[model samples]
Target: MDTTALAHAFTQACTREGFTELVEVEREAHGLWDTHTHPFEAKALILAGEIRIRTEDGTDRTYRAGEVFHLQHEEPHAEWYGPEGVRYLVARRSRAG
Candidate 1:
């Protein structure tokens, strides 16, 4: 599906999953790898391009458009993008649970 349809589907899924907010973000086409942590839980849906994610000491996974990934609260992880960069929709839940 296209970004628009994927965005809408992600919004609906977020609502069902009790996410309080949804945001769409676009990453530029560049090779960047960074490690970070988030205070809230992130449930994201890939809308375009590709992403490779690795937890601090866990397995790594590559996610492409139409794929979904979850990041838990305070989970330290690193990520890098494909040559085309990526566009994704993220839904955030305030509570750790």
Candidate 2:
């Protein structure tokens, strides 16, 4: 689909889904969840509040609502709620060899 068409499709999909929809989920509070390297890279968008992320390189960042960020495959990292708390949508895809 063209960009416009693809966007329309996504809009429809988002609107059709309920807020409390159940998707694959894993909750980890400081090493509680598995942190194995992902087979692919990924990205996440902050839908509400703020989020704090720490990378293996010792780098850290915070993302607020409407903000988007990326994660490279094999890059170790951890994510948590910022002072105001946060919720985000995480999108991932396996890397192509």
Candidate 3:
């Protein structure tokens, strides 16, 4: 789907899934992030370039444009941006007690 249509559908899905916030993020080319955790769960749709994420279990996966990935709240993981950098739309949902 085109970018506009993809974004709309993604937004709707996020809302239906109880995501409270949505944001667009861009990472610099070849950038790497050390293992980290988030307070909220995240679901993202890649819009440009690529990103590879590695979890504590050593499971690594690359997500390219038009692809989606999800991380649960406080799930430790590291990120690497592809040569051309990456851009994606992410939806976040706060963890319930």
Candidate 4:
């Protein structure tokens, strides 16, 4: 699907799934982030370039334009951006008590 359609569909899905926040994110080329965790669950759709994420299990996976990745609340992970950098739309839902 095209970017517009993809974004629309993603938004609808996120809303249905109880995501309360949506945002666009961009990363610099060849950048890296040390392992971290988020208090909220996240779902993202890659829009440009590519990204590699290393999960707590040490498994690394690359996500390129048009792909999607998800992380559960407090799930430890690290990120690496591709040479051309990356952009994505992300939806986040807070963890319930």
Clash pairs for candidate 3: none
Better of 1 and 3 by lDDT: 3
**Model 2 regions lying over 4 Å from their true place:** 1-36
Cα lDDT of model 4 overall? 0.95
Query: What tens digits encode model 3's per-residue C-alpha lDDT throughout 33-87?
Result: 9999999999999999999999998999999999999999999999999999999
Clash list (residue pairs), candidate 4: none
lDDT of 1 by residue, 1-97 (tens): 6778877878898889889888887777766668899888999999889888999888799999999999988889988888899888899998744
State how far residue 45 of model 1 sits from its true place (Å): 0.8
Tell me the tens digit of each residue's lDDT in model 4 across 17-84: 99989999999999999999999999999999999999999889999988999999999999999999
Candidate achieving higher lDDT, 1 or 4:
4
| lDDT score at residue 39, model 4, on the 0-100 scale | 92
Ranking by TM-score: 3, 4, 1, 2
In order, candidate lDDTs are 0.86, 0.55, 0.96, 0.95
Off by over 4 Å in 3: none
List clashing residue pairs in candidate 1.
none
Q: Score residue 40 of candidate 4 by CA lDDT.
A: 94
Q: Model 1's lDDT to the true fold?
A: 0.86
Model 3, residue 30: what's the lDDT?
99
